[model samples]
Target chain A: MSTDSVTVHGYSTSGNCHKVRLVLEQVGRPYQWIEVDSPNGATRTAAYLAKNPNGKVPMLERADGAVLTESNAIICWLAEGTPMMPTDAWQRAQALSWLFFEQYSHEPYVAVARFVRGWTPIDSPRRADLPRLIERGEQALAVMERHLGRHKWFTGPGYGVADVALFAYTHCAADGGFDLGKFPAVEGWLARVGRTPHFVPMPLPHDDVRTLLAQH
Target chain B: MSTDSVTVHGYSTSGNCHKVRLVLEQVGRPYQWIEVDSPNGATRTAAYLAKNPNGKVPMLERADGAVLTESNAIICWLAEGTPMMPTDAWQRAQALSWLFFEQYSHEPYVAVARFVRGWTPIDSPRRADLPRLIERGEQALAVMERHLGRHKWFTGPGYGVADVALFAYTHCAADGGFDLGKFPAVEGWLARVGRTPHFVPMPLPHDDVRTLLAQH
Candidate 1:
């Protein structure tokens, strides 16, 4: 086992998992990817649960057997000593703040809406949550619009981890029924993030999920 | 205005706000506290929204007028360069992993349960969310229990910001209808956190809220 490479257990279509791959590709880190069927209960198995008590994906395991969980935390650790994370204390704090905001305020609404829409059965009772999710998701987008209006990036002076974390879900928020055109500044920022060097997009979902996403 | 100290604007009974204060006190830092009525409409006012467009309490403002939002972010920043925050890169990453888990997996369910039960009207529709919140909150506590059964603390071999972050909501989880007695390991860890140096408890809620908490 080479300690120089890490292994990531993740579901490819998941934005949270995809962010780790994006960061690894951006920074040219050596790693192996093991696709977990997240929506199909791969993450819920006893073996997986033993490794991550929370039973979530995008888990990173070093060759030396040390494991790290949480996509943002994994990327941040991979970005350490790299320009992807700010060197200044206060700037680092702001970046971290955006990260927390992305997970708490943004993902719970935006990403979950996308999941319920694209992944669940078309008539799943979860569809009832769509209206509230979209409402709350738009509020998060407005907050991003306000910030992007004055500042170009969530990470200090650059397109960095916060951008990666937010982009994972925000880029595909339309699948969740969000109208991105309403926030011109956020739309502009999204394009800018896409244009960054070594940028990689999340893989498309299967045809069934894609069709569901397009239907509504 | 002197830039020597930071001021925290927060609701007194909120666990998120109290974590910031606990970190500051533990670090022996000079800071000012401003109370905000979060359950009311105070966080949504034009003045409050100007500083924080997200319209949340537990905002940290430096004397220079620079403001930071997000409870975990504020406490991590305050704990930086102190024993409260680990210096080693890998250890810091582990600590951060716990911080993210506390917010994403834990707080939304645990803290919101408490808010719904204790602060909302007896017949408020939000009370309907308590059962689901408590179920999810128990999963989080179980994860903590599994960890605490093996490790002394969440912050990488010591009591640190991760401890403070998890302690915020976990200590008062009963108000959310969680049975901490099921997690003996977690209960022991909470006691250890309370015994830490310069530890201070969260302020109690108003009489009406307290009465509401005890009724059901």
Candidate 2:
């Protein structure tokens, strides 16, 4: 696939969006990135919602006008038939299980907390939910810690999209008030993911959000 | 694959688990069902957690000891090469997007509200969340309503796992205090899914939970 034929609409700071970028980068697939400022009402715009009724990012648009949404789904499509996706059906299912885990179990708590802390004002009423978010996020981290104790990668036998899916939110979980120090195995796994070839870090939150993150 | 070689550990009331059973039934694959009462601490047991580190129900186990969790992944595996899964890569990605949306956007609100309303006492503090859950669940329903208005099914030109994934929670969304009267298109889609070959409805919640649900 030609890099210029694919366009990704995403907010750079979002772990969900960053997961797609990470996979594309790791695979050396070039694509255009259109910044969709989700936190500031961009995604909810009628124009954006027309593209994705769910009003979220990142969204992939092909040259033929075909569109695919959901971060994990997009990354899976980008990495199809590559080393990033397991060829074995059972292992692929196992990898997809972790992808679902990242979205359902891990991201909701960890990523939402990060969004709340960084994007909202320090005294925003939403901040009140931080304690519960942190607790739940820790539980998710614990699950990863246990898995990492016995396995080197979330995808069977190698680094792949599952690791990328997980690493997106997990590496930034501390910003959500999670104590990564308590989960050494997860910390090591995060390091391993970061050291993978062609790895690119999620960009820093924009300046205004960075200021709020620091205050929170 | 012989049905005798498959075992599914699940909570009958959970939409996630029920999606797996619905697919197995639709596909005419008979499998052993081990009822794990998740809300009653069944999934948290050390034995159950050993089989699924995430400690969630709807786990698929093979005779060879391989296990897969995450309802969408399990259903996709069960539906592989069948009409339930799209053969075209774009349609498959689109189906997966709905699966992700079902878990992230839809289930968290719709399914959780149903669990709270059906399992908790009317006066329980969790009931306080019902208003918010209803609001968000409606948003998810609206998205589905918009899509169903244009497409008869979530997957391209046919009913598939995406339909099953959304149907598991959506068909029972009224239990979560959502008034389906507003979403005519979605209501029609649900009925269409019910008429699919070999369809099976989710089992009713248990007697005590029924009492709680009635009172709520």
The 0-to-1 C-alpha lDDT of every candidate, in the order given, reads 0.93, 0.89
Question: Which ten residues in a row are the worst by lDDT in model 2 chain A?
Answer: A1-10
Judged by whole-model lDDT over C-alpha atoms, candidate 2 comes out at 0.89
Q: TM-score for model 1?
A: 0.98
In candidate 1, what fraction of native interface contacts survive?
A: 0.85
Residue pairs of candidate 2 with colliding backbone atoms: none
Q: On residues B1-216, what C-alpha lDDT tens digit does candidate 2 reach at each position?
A: 335458999988788998998999888887899999888898888899898878898999998888999999999999887888998877888898899899999998999999889988878899999999999999999999998888899977888999999999999988888899999999999999999999988889889888887774
Give the candidate number with the greatest lDDT: 1
Model 2: lDDT of residue A151: 95
lDDT string, candidate 1, B115-206, tens digits: 99998899999988888998999999999999988899999888999999999999999998899999999999999999999999998889
What is the iRMSD in Å for candidate 2?
0.7
